[model samples]
Target: MFKMKEKWRYLKTEDKTAYANMAIDRAVLVANSECKVSPTVRFFTWNPPAISIGYFQSLEDEVNLEMCKNIGVDYVRRITGGGAVYHESELTYSIVIPESHPQVPKNIMESYGRICGAVIKGLKNLGINSNYIPVNDIIADGKKISGNAQTRKLKTVLQHGTILTDVDVNKMFLLLKVPDEKIKDKLIADVKQRVTSIKHILGDDINFNETAKAMKAGFEEEFNVDLVEGQLTSYEKELAKRFEIEFFGSKQWNHRR
Candidate 1:
């Protein structure tokens, strides 16, 4: 005799500032670890065009704050470490699982690979032939369509990534700093060549909602679990607010070395 596995919570949240979004993800991670909520598959959007630097990134080095201000772009630091990402017209998803979950791997790289594999599967469900490229990226036709980051906290593993509905290389370059001006043109060209989007691949027939549906199906199938729609608990919301005030919204936290 065997027991049936539990279903995952599917959190469909509205667009929010970069700060609130990251704070919520961290709060969910903590809540799940403390047995407050079921493991979650959260999908969200960024309201204004935003820039998020990796937790360990030097904001001064990677981002041009003046440019962000001039363009009215929101910015925040993520708890999970990764390269800087400009959030414009993209869909973001986060998965929170207890560290002891059977699906999670003990090895860090293996954990990354496991999450990226689910992402690849999600892209595939969207009609894109995407593949997990070793670490934390999902590529299609040799160009990156998705990039992910992971972190562990309170005995839980949280992984999040973005699926570009469309890529704005020019805008992205405006926010992220390039070391050499001489090679700036070349760098932009190289980036355009290396990154892709769902709209680019599937044309106008596909959209954000459709892409999200595909990803939801992909994760459910990949993990062999169901996605039951849910919302953040009051405790998680309060914790997120504290995180926003103390960390995501604070210059000290964003610029901390």
Candidate 2:
């Protein structure tokens, strides 16, 4: 059985835009590699709202650009692959581990499953039963409660996921063009009925801090490792500053179709 090392760091960041959050994830990965920082887990949220398209998705196909601008929502591309996602009323979690680490699974799907298992445990603690769907989703009653993506480089892997605490289903439908022929209205209605949130499932508002603490505890218990509260290393901070100016904040990267 694989076991993680004792050294693990946890970071909880202030709310940021989607692009900056993604850039920070990459910067942390680079910093970990260069500084040999221990495996890291980060929790964060978005502010001013944003929409993120998957690494390989076409913006025109996935987003209504005019609608987004009119609504004051920013748009950016993710470093990981998945369908487009609207990032509001969501808490995002990311874990970066060296590929050489024993706890890091060899297969991508296995890695996702392991990380999502922590989320499942966390939600269960709050009385919201959730299950990990293969390939990177956490589902509750057949509707997606969370979605994840992964990126690997230089013998390091970064896995991140979004936990949908609350979402605007109607606005989501409006911003992204759903294939009308794929699913009939009845099936769509069924999906909406099944998809739910902590608030929906438990009949109470789920606070972000409570959720984050629960998730951190779940990770600690699942991995059987002590988590040290930490901040971004100097290297990571510098890299994030550079990345924000050059790529994440650039129109070329954001508008690149």
Candidate 3:
């Protein structure tokens, strides 16, 4: 009875660097708003792992540059504002839709609820019982497994989140600063208690493709739409390339805030 747009591009991409990852999201948002592309559901992963901070968060306060460089973890600042996320062993999804779409919620908070519910449904598809923690997070059995960030620009809404397949608390604490060594140990312990991953819950090293498939079904069931397999156009690819070189990868942009 509540049928809306059924056609949505499903772009399941390969693992990429932090720069390229951020770029693709921006490309989709811009292209869709300009009517150059259709609404899309993108799933991707990070190669070499990466740390992405919110647009408003301070890079210095949130991440340790030396640790990142020493450990070879890519880092960038996202256009969407939220907390930092360590993109490692995770399935990341990005949803791009026109702000004026009849089915899409107009209010920001309501929009987050709508989108995050789809993510919750996705986890359910994996047989992982998780609850939406509101504002922008999903917790599985009292431990967080997914975190999302969103932004609206050029009349388009872009919401992206990470469904962690595995979490390296030792590695994460190294990248994110706490305080003293004692605090660092306590922080790691606290994080281990708070954050969780699919691998941990399933008790196996489940492939990301498997998780991606579950996500597809989850969003489909939750949103009542089909995810038509699609590819990126030349325009978005070109823009992503430019963004990689100029925006995401550039120190000026990464350290600006």
Candidate 4:
């Protein structure tokens, strides 16, 4: 029997506070697990900027909370395991799909390579050559341009990541705590050498929508599916609010190692 053609939801770009963004991703994952929504791809940007740490990372060890607050940057812990990331001047995307889906590899590393391939295609759309460097990074010209993280819950997989349009390594270092202040300068210099952004490569600033558009097309092509534009359902909205209050925005959740 021939398989049915696939169509995934494409949520266009929106700017949101850090808590709301994380809440929405989780809400969508839950909704998709219940089979209430189609496999979805959504893009968004951070408002007022923020720092998101991995699930297993210690908050105090990873982030300088006082500096974050003083500089009006939001901070939160993610449900996915990885290093901390400073969200700003970039496009963030989340994709929700079932683990049993044929296109999704059961092996975590292969799955990362497959999903990160979509991002590589997206960069190509913008006339940039990039490659996927496992376990979860995309690079351009030997410098990292994107970082991704994933989690499997309720038998569903949610992978989200950032595609940097511009980078400010200096500002990011200020908000992230260093194990020893002595190596701070060397670390920053090393990062600057190892990381890059769209603007740095293209010599132009690509706005959020344009970057998102490229990424959407990338997923469609990589998965061989149509991406239909959509919005959050009422149920998703309500769930996001609850998630924000109970988890993402809560002091207890963010502070919990």
The model with the greatest TM-score is 4
How do the residues 128-200 of candidate 4 rate in per-residue lDDT, one tens digit apiece?
9999998999999999999999999999999999999999999999999998899999999999999999999
As a whole number from 0 to 100, the lDDT of residue 243 in candidate 4 is 99
Q: Which prediction has the highest lDDT against the true structure?
A: 4
- Which has the better lDDT: candidate 1, or candidate 4? 4
Steric clash count of candidate 4? 0
1 or 2: which has the higher TM-score? 1
Q: What is the Cα-based TM-score of model 4?
A: 0.98
List, in order, the clash count of every candidate structure: 0, 0, 0, 0
Cα misplacement distance, residue 228 of candidate 2 (Å): 1.6
TM-score of each: 0.97, 0.92, 0.96, 0.98
Candidate with more favorable, higher lDDT: 2 or 4: 4
Give the residue spans of candidate 1 off by over 4 A.
2-5
RMSD of each: 1.2, 2.7, 1.6, 1.1
Please, what's the RMSD in Å of model 3?
1.6
Question: Candidate 3, residues 1-257: lDDT per residue as tens digits?
Answer: 96674878999887789899999999989889889988899999999889999999999988999999998999999999999888888999999999998768999988888899888888898889999887898899899999998899988999999999998998888898765766777778888999999989989898978988999988888778889999999999999999889999999999997
- The global C-alpha lDDT for each of the candidates, from Candidate 1 onward, is 0.89, 0.82, 0.90, 0.94
10 residues in a row with least lDDT, candidate 2: 179-188
**Residue 171 local lDDT, model 4:** 99
